[model samples]
Target: MPDQVLELAGVAVLVCDPAGPPVTTTQDALDLIGAAFLGAEVVAVPASRLNEDFFSLGTGFAGEVMQKFVNYRLRLAVLGDISRHLAASSALRALVHESNRAGHVWFLPDLDALEARLTTPT
Candidate 1:
């Protein structure tokens, strides 16, 4: 019954609170995803507050964590609009693009869109 894990459209998702800085360390991200994956096939990371030190997952942090996701074949979903981040460094934009293209991650605007994607056949 924890908010962390829920079933929607026959897919399991692990939702993490995005109230503060994004998890910057790979260990933290891994721990979070590992815990969530216990009951879900996907992980949802909310974007409540952008991290000051690093964008999402900190600078150069996403790649490392992403590798783990690839290894585990886990899907990651970042819920929120990224209009403000569009102006960020080109590297960040590239990373976001790569993540999306990999089909293992997403940066959606809202829960509805996220749910839609989750339900849609891949």
Candidate 2:
């Protein structure tokens, strides 16, 4: 796995590629967030590289990650289209819809959209 800080749309983002199972353990998620928060205003995680499940982090692991997001008051941007996931799970599609409605996280199509969303005034 490779983890590093990257600048996106004038924001420093900590990017990580676990290159294994799609699921990220809560502990690992926390560690990544902690590291990312230091140098970046936002964190972008690639769903494909981390896990193989329908949802990038898997449903169980995603809940834990969401808790961390609340605890840290951090905004998360998940990169890539989730067409594969949408095809696999109706529940996941609903979850993604709810997440977007809440505005704490975003499942964006590409870096440009991600960057624009991050930089645009809320």
Q: What TM-score goes with each of the models?
A: 0.78, 0.77
Per-candidate RMSD vs. true structure?
2.9, 3.0
Q: Which ten contiguous residues of candidate 1 have the minimum total lDDT?
A: 48-57
lDDT (tens digit, per residue) of candidate 1 on 50-111: 34333644556656766777788888787787767757667678877776665787777766
The digit string of per-residue lDDT tens for model 2 on 1-122 reads 57777787777877666463344467766776777767676667776744553264454667777778777877777788678878888887888888766657777777788778767766
- Where is the poorest 10-residue window by lDDT in model 2? 50-59
Question: Cα lDDT for residue 35, model 2?
Answer: 79
- Candidate 1 residues lying further than 4 Å off, grouped into runs, are 20-22, 49-58
